[model samples]
Target: MPSTHNPGSSSPLTSFGRSIWSRREPFHSIEADHESSEQELELQSFQKLVVDLFHDLSAVSADELLSIAWIRKLLDVFVSCLDEFRVLLLKNKAQVSKPPLDHWADEYLDRSLKALDICNATRDGIEKIRTWHKHLEIVMCALESRKRAFSEGQFRRARKALMDLTLEMLDERDSGSVFSHRNWSFGRNNPRKDARRRQHSSGNSSGHSRSHSWSISNSWSAAKQLQSIANNLIAPRGNEIVATNGLAGSVYTMSSVLTFVLSALVAAIPCQDRALSTHFSIPQQYSWEEQKVEVEQELQELASICENFKNGLDPLERQIRQVFRRIMNCRTEGLEILSRANNLE
Candidate 1:
């Protein structure tokens, strides 16, 4: 403290202190810059994560819907996608209904996933999510086009497709989950009756139940197969994974033929029960009462059957008699009237 000014002021310590202050200022600036850079990177990562999550949410197809809850979720997802899409495109100074993603998406993806590297979980997840996003974009575009078609009265094309879609959607909404919980849930499509009979006759050990993880394309194929069956355009194929209603064209045809044959046989043949002409032999005790009841019931039923079978008989008889009587009356009465008129004249 006594020599505070003199020695210290011009000493090496002073120069050292000045040098340290200069270094400290730059280091502090670097630290601030590094913090800012870290924050920017974090923000970019957050934005990309949001986009991916939304992509997963947005990409729902009709085939993906298996239940009412799923359909509802799909609709909600579609709306959300539309909203976000509109916001994004508008922010980018483009039309909301018609996004310019196609022009930019490839480049963006190429650049974005380049940093992610292949064979990484993040890359795989992002690729799947991106595909879903694109699919959702297509559906969203279709929906908008459908609405425009209605507004413009392109009713024939739009109405047909829309109506079919609505019906399919309803079917999906009303159905249970397509996911199989049990091993036998992977049932085959309709087997030929002959093949099934042979299998039953031979043995029940043809194959084991198969399990398949769901994919977007698999779901779509299953849906299309079901629709084909429903529309009866193609018979249900063997080993169909979904809607194993076992509806086969051959079976349907066989059933129809059998029904026709049975009906024809019934119409062409009469009851040939020989016992119908046999005598009723009974014990004396209950003979009279039972016979009387039985005969009366039989007679009543026979009478009813006969009553319904008038066919052309009653009307034909009436018409014939009516014509004869009219002819005879005309001959007799007409002669009398003519005779009376002649006399009066």
Candidate 2:
């Protein structure tokens, strides 16, 4: 028979191709050709699958309000896809050594690596969100404690806690001093650092500085308002513990002032509505007397002011609730995606 194969050419696939070509057991040249075509088709299918996965990942990552839950969902998908892609790459590595197939494998691998990088970035973003969430929770808990103390008439405890919280917030506002001197020195210790490092550090510092300033301003304002109310309530001789027999008339003045002050405090602290039911604790022995009509009139005005403050907080509270709802929605969506991906796997 005439030679059908080239002997000088060193194509890697040539040997495998020739072996299949020389096969005689029902696998003829036509079958060999079909088999080679099938391998090419499989490679193309795998490449397409990878491309589609990348598109899905990119879409999720590009979302403006990318939450931790969403990122976790994407990371799960990427990890699964990467595992499958790596396996496919290995399977095809030995079976195919041709031009376009090899190129496709290499390209897919590169894209998979890029997806991993995105996964890492998403993880970092999630960590930052977690930190912020933790900080918010701590602030909420502190507010709750202060409210409880005040409601229970632990005036001194409430005042001290509020003052400590305020001072801590103020100290935190001085960002440069919040961290240890050693940590601060580490960043500037190397004068020989590249310009890119300096630029990046400066950019991050400036952004953090702005955020810290805003947070400090809000906290300081809230703290000052709370302190003013506390001072008014605990003023010398203003909040004396009078006898129940004399309380009807003697305590009426302090009680009215306290009622007004407590109402204002409740209005200032948006989360303390449940704790600050009715600010006054008139002794069971005495009833509301006509002698205190003037004090009641002033109390009514203060109540109106408190009502205004509560109304102002409604919009803010609504906005906060909306944000929480959005986060919950993201978490639900992520769980759904993860479940679907798990089913596929």
Q: Which candidate is the best by lDDT?
A: 2
Q: How would you encode candidate 2's per-residue C-alpha lDDT over 129-195 as one tens digit per residue?
A: 2333344334333334323122323323434444554443444334322122222211233233233
Supply the global lDDT for candidate 1. Answer: 0.28
Tens-place lDDT per residue, model 1, 1-345, is 011223234443234223322322222343454454433333233333333443443343433322223323323432333233223323332211122222222222222221111111111222222333343333333334323112323323334443444443344334421221112112322245235334323224232111112222212322232223223222223332012111121122212222222222122211111001223232223333335456446545544333422232223222222322322332233334334544655
Clashing pairs in 2: none
Local error of candidate 2 at residue 40 (angstroms): 6.1
TM-score of each: 0.16, 0.27
> Candidate 1 — which residues are off by over 4 angstroms?
1-65, 94-102, 105-345
Candidate 2 accuracy as lDDT: 0.30
Q: Model 1 clash pairs? A: 189-239
